[model samples]
Target: MASNVHSLSARRTAGKSAAMMPPSPPPENLELDGLDRLLGAIYEGPMESPPWQNASQLLRERLGAAHVTLMLRPPSQDGSGAMINTGPTQQQHVDSYESHFFAADPFVRLPEGEVFSAEELIGPQWLQSQYYREFLQPVGVRHLLGADIYTREGIECRLRVTRGPEALPFDAGDKSLLRRVLPHFKRAIQLHARLDFLECERALFAGTVNRMLLGMISFDQNGQLLETNQEARRILAERDGIWLSGNNLCIDSSQESRDFQRMLRQALSGGTHPRAGSEPELVEAIAVSRPSGRAKLGILVRAIPLGPWSESKQRPAVAVFLRDPEANAAQPSQELVRRLFGLTRMEAQLALLLTEGLTLDEAAEKMNVRRNTARTHLRSIFCKTGVTRQTMLVRLLLNSVLSLG
Candidate 1:
């Protein structure tokens, strides 16, 4: 960890030193129209598959190079990093560079936002280096141009261009063009990072809701459906007690439907109704009976939060949460249960069945075991878990974090 920290610090220091240097003036012939097109491609990078494919391809063509590559993440000792290449280089060579040569290559950590050649950075000794001799030589690659980009988001990445041994070395024109576009590339990378973070957070919260077995449904001010999670979609599709009727929620019973609609209207009205001050009116709950006679579906309606000066149209201003009594809550696997309580396979199975509200006899019947054997497993489970009775054992397992797994 200390070595990793030092490496990052050194890289940042190099970037800072490079950034302190003033950039050269843009060339007179540099076409703004082409740059504008490239900028559009760059901004569209975050949404593209393989990210920045079109932009990078355009960049490669613009630079007139054989290959263009982006090291979105630099290689580390742990073998983590991404390298997207727009060349015909064989996959094996790419894999080899990522696995082995990345450490020895001296072309990295280029002056931040400043493009430079391998010859410029390494002087005359560039051709004699182990990385060049063993890897670059074998692949017939010679000329190299690279720039480092650093973003406010702490993202440090490198862009590299390579040409064949016979091709001319990258000149001032190539470097200048790359220098002009490096900032935009940095911004695109930052945007991609933020988008990735948000998607991860969304998935985490959605997964938690699913694990809790709650059916979440959101509605706009007009009581039109806005969003529904997987659980809510399942319940609605079944159409047991409550479902959709042309995007509007409908209850099976006429009286219950009227009550539900009244609550929705009151909630969507921003709580300005006559019953606003009453405790029961703040959050209304109803039990809708199902035609299948399984169990009543629990529904809770509440108003969405509003700002003092908020005035948005067709936005979510009501929330309806549904709970089906017959739906099974997520349970910990038998292996997880065994590991958590030091119980054997049979004991874990019995414990899980009990946690599901099953009697010892019913569990024994399901497991194809005698009732006495089930009782023995139960006693062992109780002793190991420090629970005196079956109910306490159930409570312990039910309250554990294993269910969230």
Candidate 2:
């Protein structure tokens, strides 16, 4: 597994003195909100971009440190690990630390989860060693205080809060604040584990019916919702005229609502359509209007045909396909365009706009670039994408499955 350490640094801070003064009091109110934020991080959105980073940042401020980093020590592959740090460290510094310097650093070679002062982890002698001069001195980090936080999946992650040379060493008060917030991190890890499982399941189910640019809703024999794709979820969440009230699917108009329920019931019961003898399975398409007076949602409802002996318990009796005319299309993978076609980021953006039916002038105006620059980007895009005419460029992009965004 490739380690993707997103902008995390391994920065250490100031020297320790035996008679160090106590740090300022921990912010109780902010820490309470920070704990809440950490719990909500797992459920906020994609697990790929959880709010744990933000929570860690909050901890940094609360603990009165220059920067905070959460690092996976002895990386999951049982090697030197990755870091997720908050600070103004360069990517070069991060790469240098993980690839070379981290292995020699004595701070990471300590006991886990127990708060340790830098003095405890590495004595003054080691701090002045060659590793310190070559690495830490240049980075301007003098010392760090750390504690290992446990995840439900048993991933080994340690939190390191750094201070600069001028700043005093982290005191007991800082350690106490970290201890208070530790339980929140422990619970957040469990939530992360559960979300991982759920997201995997959602991907599997959505892949079945929503591979195309369509939203799907699976309903049971009693018109109860069994499941829905992410797109269907967005439509339901909007409550724009059509929404789900309890388990029942509902539309705006009372007359249309009655018709929708009747059609849904018929489809769910596996009964013949009104024109069953001729059409057998006529797809029932409806225009669901929005209460906001926006464009109507186009929904197509149809019955799932199965043999009398079929024993699929999880199968849906009725499926609804929803499409909002105004909904944004799935963005294509800009990475793919850059890698495959060698278009620069700006050129790729212009290419995407061109595909979206935007004229050169319009694309320029939207990009906030002059028309000449836009034309220059367009020319580069044409060369890279292997197309000349705007029509051909649109055709290539429309047919290709590069839009992973």
Candidate 3:
């Protein structure tokens, strides 16, 4: 695994001595509505960009603390980790903790799933420690309440809340409240990690499909378009053979339209049907004729698979993949092409045009160059690409990952 350390330094105010203060009285009774809202925020934390910002704020308010910091990933010497702090502390204070003070602080590695205070964990000796004088005291962090959660997903997260000397120290009531919500908090972190992984995979596959010059369109059970990629939108906007009529997929030819609708219905049925003891759904294909006399658009219709326990929702039931044989294949930038094959600008441009299905004479005319110049560039492209024929050169360029750039 790679390190997550980043330059997270920021500016903050000067520190003050943390006077030994008596523990404050226990807090008021926890309200049912407040608990409900806090639980909701905890689950929603994973979806937040900074993860758990709302939950951290709510927890801070509930505890009446100066700051609430959730160390989703602990800070390291290299200054890499995921930490969220909810407080009015200066950026420098945060920078100090993330960059350097984190290592010296003795509040970490708490008893798993148990909440503890600075006094309970470190005793009276904590006040004389270097961490208190140089780091916590300077920022007015006098009292600390912390809990550690180790999930099955291999995440060791710490929740810490601090109070200034002016405020009362944490009490039994505060620890009780934290203990009550700790289980929910652990589950939320697990849910977030799982979702984060799934989202990354989804983006990777989506980008690969788009780079392949394939148009993907997904439809709901009602035949309404649910989602589409950039290539699909581009193909529909051209309106050569297939396009959208309102929100419905359409073909220029009546016969093809009927065929497409039938296939779409079959695909939808396959997706929603019971999966147990069912035969695999057959993928359907069709060629949509163009009015402009261009090559027919190749379309493949298939069902989006569903798990046995899938719920009823407005989701993609059928998917359509469109391939335009006459359309230009996605090409890398001229500079990229030049670097990949060690070809000059002119040679790279000529190679790109050839990949678009243009003949040497047509490409030369487009580039405002003579046919003989185009031929010379072509010969050079073949030699640089280690191919002997024009078709081989085109095939090589199309098969390469250059288009993914």
Candidate 4:
């Protein structure tokens, strides 16, 4: 009876040991349909929304893991200087770790395509290192699974999954799962970076347009206004050229209006004027004429090539300029200041004399005004604006009015 009882106990012990052993081959073929479904969800909307926060939650549910994190190494700094936590925790931990352990981290230094097991991460030798004890263990992380996201711009983003102490070490199944979903993560990272770049480019373009002096008006090939810079809007509004009819630009003066329309028609036709050879001649023609008191206003027409690959080879454009003797006649006012500031008759006359190196007395004499009266007008002009002296005033005026034209 004693022998039989001992035999039964030994058999039961053997059965428990066998059950406790890790499953052979680690179930590497576990179902990946759920992972595919998760990836599909991420791609459903604009990549920015349902951002990393949403992604972390979905990954936690699908992978049955305790936490997940995404870290970014900015080009300006070494190691993972910019870390994003997409896990349950609101604050970031990896950034703090990277700052302290950048030089000691084997995973960061390892080349692409290399893989490491969780045992290697938490082993006594590795764990003894300050980084492991101070950063990883305190956070309840016993195992780590990591992969790299590479970009064409030479940036590397690291994605990591962490498991708790009670959980079994990441098995072959987990590694296989990571391998299958890595491509999706890579796509997400690239998409996110691209969206960020596009936003920055949009802001830069807007800033540049706002800073320009020459009013810029963009039109479709059909002569419909697509967009206008602030300066262009102001000019159009002042000249009564902005029209609500079918979103078209309309000039008030009949002759100038006709010229603008003709120039636009030519531009849209995509026809190039005959040239002598392969080198096309750059030419400007008069498109419109308007009478402003004793002076004539004209729109100068030209053709500019849209791009290196444009089929039209040339795009038609028109620039409006004053043909008034007062505007064209070389005198005291620099051409730019007269056009930009809407200076009064006296102000323009004063500016021209100053630009030609004339003294206050000399300018006053030329203008047939008393010295005291000229000085008074100059003082009023300086005070209305913030210019304190002549040189500074000249610079300010030039900066406000000048353009690449």
Pairs with backbone N, CA or C atoms under 3 Å apart (clashes), candidate 3:
5-80, 10-92, 11-92, 12-92, 15-138
For model 4, give the RMSD to the true fold: 14.8
Query: Per-residue CA lDDT of candidate 3, range 112-180, in tens?
Result: 878999889999999999999999888888999999999877999999999999999899999999999
Residue 70 lDDT in model 1? 92
Q: What is the lDDT of residue 284 in candidate 3?
A: 94
Score each candidate by Cα lDDT.
Answer: 0.86, 0.73, 0.86, 0.60
Task: Give the clashing pairs for model 4.
Answer: 259-287, 332-351, 332-352, 332-353, 333-352
Prediction RMSDs, each to the true structure: 16.0, 19.4, 15.8, 14.8
- The number of the candidate with the highest TM-score is 1
TM-score, structure 1 vs. true: 0.74
- Candidate 1, residue 67: the lDDT equals 88
Model 4 lDDT vs. the true structure? Answer: 0.60
Backbone clashes in model 1, listed as residue pairs? none
Arrange candidates by TM-score, highest first: which order? Answer: 1, 3, 4, 2
lDDT of 1 by residue, 1-405 (tens): 999999999999999999998886577436776788899999999999899889989998888888889989988898667988897789898889888999988987777877899888998899999999999888888998899988777888989999998988888999998999898999899999999999899899888887878898888766778889999989999999889887888899998999998888888774442232333335789999999998899999877665445566576677789998889876678899888999999999999988888889999999999999899988899889998999898889878877677
The estimated TM-scores of all candidates read: 0.74, 0.47, 0.72, 0.48
Candidate 2: deviation at residue 367, Å?
49
Candidate closer to the true structure by TM-score (higher is better), 3 or 4: 3
